[model samples]
Every structure is written in structure tokens, then in C-alpha cells.
Target: MKKNYFFSIVALLTVSLGSMQGQVVNGTFENIKDNGLISNWGMNFFTPITIDAETGETTQDFITFGCWPGFVFPSWDANHGQHAMQMTNGLNVTTNTIIPAKSILFNDPKQDIPGWNPGIPVDLSDQVAMLGFDYKFTRMGNDIAEAELVVFGTDGQELGRATVDISQTNTQYQYLYEPVQFTSFGIPASIQVSFSMAKEGSVPAFGSTLIVDDVIVSYAALANDEFQSTQFIVYPTVASSEINIVKGSTAPSGNYNFTITNMEGKTVSNQSIQLSDNNPFTVDVSQLSKGIYFISSKGFSTKFMKQ
Candidate 1:
């Protein structure tokens, strides 16, 4: 039963074709088909391949099968346009496991076919900082919905990644912006954006829907600019022991509260610093574990790495 679920997920990365190019297209979910298919994106649905006994020809039958009414569909609860994409968590009766509706800028060639590669073509001509989207989530129990953005180099090495999760129930749409932290190890060539109704360990619950719209590739900093730009500059993104927060030209001349959080959004350190002079303010991060961490004051945020 678990093996069947494994193949089903692999199918998601294999289905889409030619139109999967560059940045996200039809992000508004406005180009939905009558049968609930969205253009320029891939949604998970079951359609078995059939072969003709007489002709020896194989073809995919246009049959949509899944949890009733399918797991993904178009909804009128849009934030930017007339329609938005909705994904719900459903139970796979045969396997008794949760089947999540997923939408992705999916890649090419069927997994059963030769030389199959998965992921969307990315064009980073612009200074892309993060992914921004508007969503409304109705979570059940401890279930959570998440969205992720990943950048891959030409050699298939991960260049950067960012993720945001919806844990609380929100009837009204809320805007979310998540940063993509680059490793500065390779040249980015492709990217993949995915949204799923629930993450691992989420208890199966019906009607836990996530409505998403206006998915945009944000090019500017996802955090506040005044402090991140003028007030201070978090330098040496890849730091070993310490990170210098240099006061910028228009830095506010006063003490402020700052916190450092890990990628899981857990605050590991809470401290205050005075920013009234030209000398750089250094923060000791040697005690923190090696991984990605974010530093922010008030609403201004930025990220760094502990090497």
C-alpha cells in the first residue's frame, strides 16, 4: 500500500509538458478547465494507462479519479481574481493513508518513460528574493498546510529554498512572503514551487481546505526595507562564529530588540542591541547549531547561515 502511494507522488513530478517554462504562469487560477484542470500547472489525479489488445497501442484514458469531486479544484474565494486554487486533504480508502492535493509547476516526461527529468524551468534574470502568495486555510486538528519554493543549479544541486506554513484557521485570505536563502555554491538553473494541504505526520481530516491565489514570484526583499536596508546590514551570510550587523547610513540611533530564529521558526536567541554608533554590532552565533537562521527586529527580517 505504501508502494502505491510512492508511485503516485512520483507521477506528480512526471506528468506536465511543454508549457512548463520559466516563471509561474496562470498564477491567478483563472484558466481552469471545465473538468477542473488548471492550465500551466499540474494537479494530482489518477488516470491509468490502457493498451489496445488488437493494435498494441498504449494511451492514457482521460479519466479523473480521486477522493470524491477530486482533491483539487477551482474556487471563487479568490484574493486577486475571480478564481483560486483549492486543495484538500482526503483519505485513500484502499491504503487508509492521507492523500493530499498538490499543485506544482511540474516537470516533463512520464516517470515510466526514459530520461525523465522533473522540475520547472527557471529564469532568474531578475533579482528574485522570495515567493509571495495569498491564502486562506481551514486546518483540522494539528494539520498544517505548507508552500515551498526551491531553486536548483544546472548540476541539480539545490541553490536555495524557502517554506511557509499555515497552522491557524483563517477565514479571510492572508498574504505570506517567504525568503529563499541561497547557498552561494552553484549557479541556479531551475526552480519548483509546490503547495500541499498537509505535511507529514498530519492526521487525516476531511474538509481541511487551503484556498490559494495570486501566487507571484517576488523580486524584492520579503522583509521590511527601512531597517534591513538603511538601519543595519547583516553581513557575511555564511558565518562561522559571529555575524556583524553594521549600522547603515540612515540607521536609527537607539537600542532595539532583535531575535534569531531557526528555519523551523523557533526562536533560539532573544537579545537587545544598541545601534547608535558607526562601529559594527557583532552577535555570537557559535553556540547555535549549524544551519539556516533568521534575524529580525520588529517586522524587519533577514537570514544568515551558521557554518
Candidate 2:
């Protein structure tokens, strides 16, 4: 995978990591250093900047092929704040290979993954229910982007996590809310949040970009019976012309609102349908492009693929 190569090369080089508590630091990518890099986040490569002894002028060099500095950068095109983090798949001039651009939250210098520190210490004294953020993604081709949030216990055990797939193109920013489901009870000691323009095993396509901003953690817990009462499922996880929305036995018969969104978090369809007893609601999805999409309603949601 491309990410494996990223860490292997980084093992030979040294870089700095950021730290914070209760929340993510520089979540908006507003705190930038004089070198035009986001403060706290580490870089995969660095360029030597020289200063003139007499003129006191400075000169910094950039790679001829890829964007300056690195794949992940701060951009004025923001969703909420003054800036946002932009990542793109580009050529690594040093290695002469195409790699995905990514940003990970890291704080522990003692904890290292071969050569990279990938998560930051987080005090989850107050339990969180969901993690959300605003993003705009432009997938060049078959490339897939991803955003992930992971929670770890004090013993370094995996407690919970949520993942959002970025498989569709969206020029406009959209919000994604993902619920975190824990596997065991423990005090969360750290958290890892990451955004990547391309994932491993994907065809690294150039010009594919993901712009992200305002990473937030929700404290309000999701209702235990939120979707259980009106449980439903989408048939033919992989679909073509149409799909069925099957309601659970406990679900009540009435008019229900339905919303369909592409992988980019863009809403493609929304309508209200009257469902009767023991009947499945058929939705026409033939018009949708070949890709993954989500069907969501008041308190229930699931995904399907349009082929």
C-alpha cells in the first residue's frame, strides 16, 4: 500500500508532531508557521532554506513537480474559519512515486509506528457520541479518500471508531456526522483523527483533492432507541436500477421521510413516502452514477452501492 511506503521512507527522516487535550489543536489549520506550513502537524519531507549573510534575505526551495512544501497544506478556501487543510495525491519528487497526502493527530513521542507518531493524547472524561467535520472532495477518477476517528483506552486497546468514505466528487462543502460505537468500557487515553486524499490499494490519481475543516466532537449521546424503534435495511448492498427499503416488524406504518446522499456527503434525493404494513418501499436509483451512497431518515441510516 502507498501508506506503507510513506512510513518506510519517513523512518529515515525526522519530523515534529502536535499535541492537545479535550479537543483537536489547529483543527481549522489557522495557526501556520513562517515557513507556510500548518503548525503542529508533521511533514514527510523538508526543503532547506538558506539565508544571505549580508542581505539577510531568505530563500526557500520547492519541488518542481508537486505543490510546495508537501501534499497537505493550508488553504484560504475554508468552510468556517480562516483556513482549512487541503490534501492531494501528487508525485513525491524525492522518491519519484505517487503517494496520498494525509494529516494525522499525533502527540506522544514515546509511541511510534515504526517511524511515525500517529495519534495525540485525549482526555475523554466526558464521553463523546459523534465526530463530525465539513469537507469538499474532488475525486479525479477511481481514487477514494477517507476520514477516520479512533478512540483508544489507557492500555492502548481499541475502544471505538468511526469512518467516512469519500468516493464521490463534491465541489461544495458538506457535513458528515458519524457515531462512534465502543467495543469495551475503559477510559479513553488518546484519539486519532486523519484525512487522506487517497487510500491504500487505490489507483493514485493526480488532481484528486480533499479540503477539510472544523473537526468537532459531539458530547450529546445518541439515543439508545434512536433507530431501533423504526429499524430498516437496504437490500442488494450492490444495486443497479432500484433498491428496496425494508422496515422492521416493529416499525409503524405511515409517511416517512427519506434522504439519499452520495459518498461525498452530497444529498442526491429526498422525499416522503407512505409505507404500508409488511411492504417494502422501492426507490429508483438507476439515475445515480456508479458509486457508494447512503440512505438515511429521521433516526436510521445505511449504505448501498449503485452499479
Candidate 3:
């Protein structure tokens, strides 16, 4: 029995070997292949074309190719690491091979196998306020490079979408952010971020480039269950002297009895107080000991720390 338990522990550890704690995979564009290709990105294939039948000379043509633009590149101009995803919408007639560029790298790159999918899946069960990234764009003539951030539900429904139009040419990278509103299902289950060097049906100009690095996802500090209605905000989550409970946005106004308990399941205190949806309520915790505690009133229950 002990030997079976030991193997169970080892199996659990092996399963969690490379799991990330937050956000998408490889957001820094640092993970690369031995051939210098970026990891977690969807890849396309390009076969050499024979231009001269006798000499076997080859060339590339934009007349027939994938919309992924130029092969995804890794540039030394990394924001916080050794490399960043450098995507360019340029054309070269050199004798070489090209492939489709994969965008929307997830937090987990190992799932990016089989070479092609609309996007790599991601887990966004955490409440995220917005998605942000650093980028620099260079377009010629009327061509523009755009970045798209999309969130999807388990049923394959698009929950929320944020789009940024990149038309101006920026030599220096700039910080940009987009808000991700939650759905009725609490948090989304998957996400895919794609980029376009030019709009549909339009061709990209030569030498156009878009470099991105360090995808940052800012999460709402509150737990999901605490603010499902965007009301009943409790402040000083780590209670010091007292705790503040504010009711906002159609919050119920009333007097309710409440109880506080310690981690040992001991009922520390019980009391009743009047509260208004507009006015804030203050609770005195000067007597409670410094530890973890749970507060329950009406139908809502939340946990906080006391110190």
C-alpha cells in the first residue's frame, strides 16, 4: 500500500512539472527551437518553386501564399528577454523555403503540435481585467498591421473581443492595453490572439514588420464569487483595524445579521448591522485575533485575513 501511494505522489509531481501559474504560454517569445524558430506558434510550410527548368533556380512569389505574412521571426529587440516575436509582411525573391506563421502563442507551448490549428487553446478561468502587450509596427504605403485579442467560451462562443488598429509606423515600441469583459458564465475557458499585417483581400507591402513581446494579463484582485454582481465590495481584504463593506450598483440595502469564524471553525463573533446601497458600512474587528476568518451574512459568504 505504501509503495502504491509513493507512485501516486510521483505521478502527481510529473503531471505538474511545467505548468504555469498565470496568463498564456511563452508570452515573452523567449522559448525557441534549435533552428531558432519560436515555440508555441502555429507553423506553415513553404516549398521551393522552380523558376528555371534547366538550372533549377527557385524564387518566391506572393501571388500564392499563406496570409500569415512572412515567416515569424525572433528579434534581439526583446522587451524583457532574449527575443521577441517579429512578424513582417515583406516579400523576397530569394531561393529559399517559407511556411505559415503561427500567432496567438498560449501559456503552454507543448500543446502546439500537429503544426496547424486556428489557434492554440488557453485557460482563462481566472478573472482578468485586461490584456496588454508591447509592440512596434512598420508598414509601407497603405498597408497596416493589426493585433487582435479574442476570448472564447467552452461552447466555442466568443465572449469578448478587443481589437487594435496599427496604421502608424513606430520605430520605438509602445505599451497598449485592451479590456476583457466577462460573460454570464463567470470566466472564459479559452483565448486566441491573432495579428493581421493587412486587411482581408489587400496585399501587404514589402518590408512591413510587426514585433511583439511580453504579453501581460492584469487580473482583477477580487475573487470571482465575491463580485458576480459587481456589488458588495469589501475592502482591506487583509483587515487591520476595521473592514469596509460598500454596496454599489443595485446592491441590496438592509440590516442583516452576520457571523465571523476562525480557521478552526470556531465562531468568533456574531452581530447585526444596518447597511445602505449608497452608504458604506464599517465593521469593528478590534477584538478578533490575527488569523484567517470567514464572514457570512444573508446569502453571501466571503473569506479574508485578519492581522
TM-score of each: 0.55, 0.57, 0.52
| Tens digit per residue, CA lDDT, model 2, 192-307 | 77776666667677677888876655422211112222467667666789988877677777788999999666899998977777688899999999765778776666566676
TM-score, predicted candidate 1 vs. hidden true structure: 0.55
Total colliding residue pairs, candidate 3: 5
Which candidate order results from sorting by lDDT in descending order?
A: 2, 1, 3
Candidate closest to the true structure, highest TM-score: 2
Q: How well is each residue in 1-307 modelled by candidate 1, as lDDT tens digits?
A: 1111112222222123343223255667777554445544555556445456666566543322233365666678876557887777656554455667666655443332112243566654534457767688887777788888888888888888888877878886666767788876776677778787776566546668888876655533222222236656787766889988876678677887889988667899998888876787899999999766778886665667676
Off by over 4 Å in 1: 1-23, 45-68, 107-118, 220-307
What is the per-residue lDDT of model 3 for residues 1-307, given as tens digits with 9 covering 90 to 100? 1111111110000000122234445667777765455666533434334455555555434322323333565679875557887776434445232222335443434443323344444454444445666788776668766667777777888788766666777776655556666554535665666666675545566556778876645433322112222445666656767987766476578776878777556898887867785676888887888755667676555555566
Residue 169's lDDT in candidate 3: 74
* Regions of candidate 2 where Cα sits further than 4 Å from its true position: 1-22, 43-69, 92-96, 108-115, 219-307
RMSD of each: 10.9, 12.4, 18.7
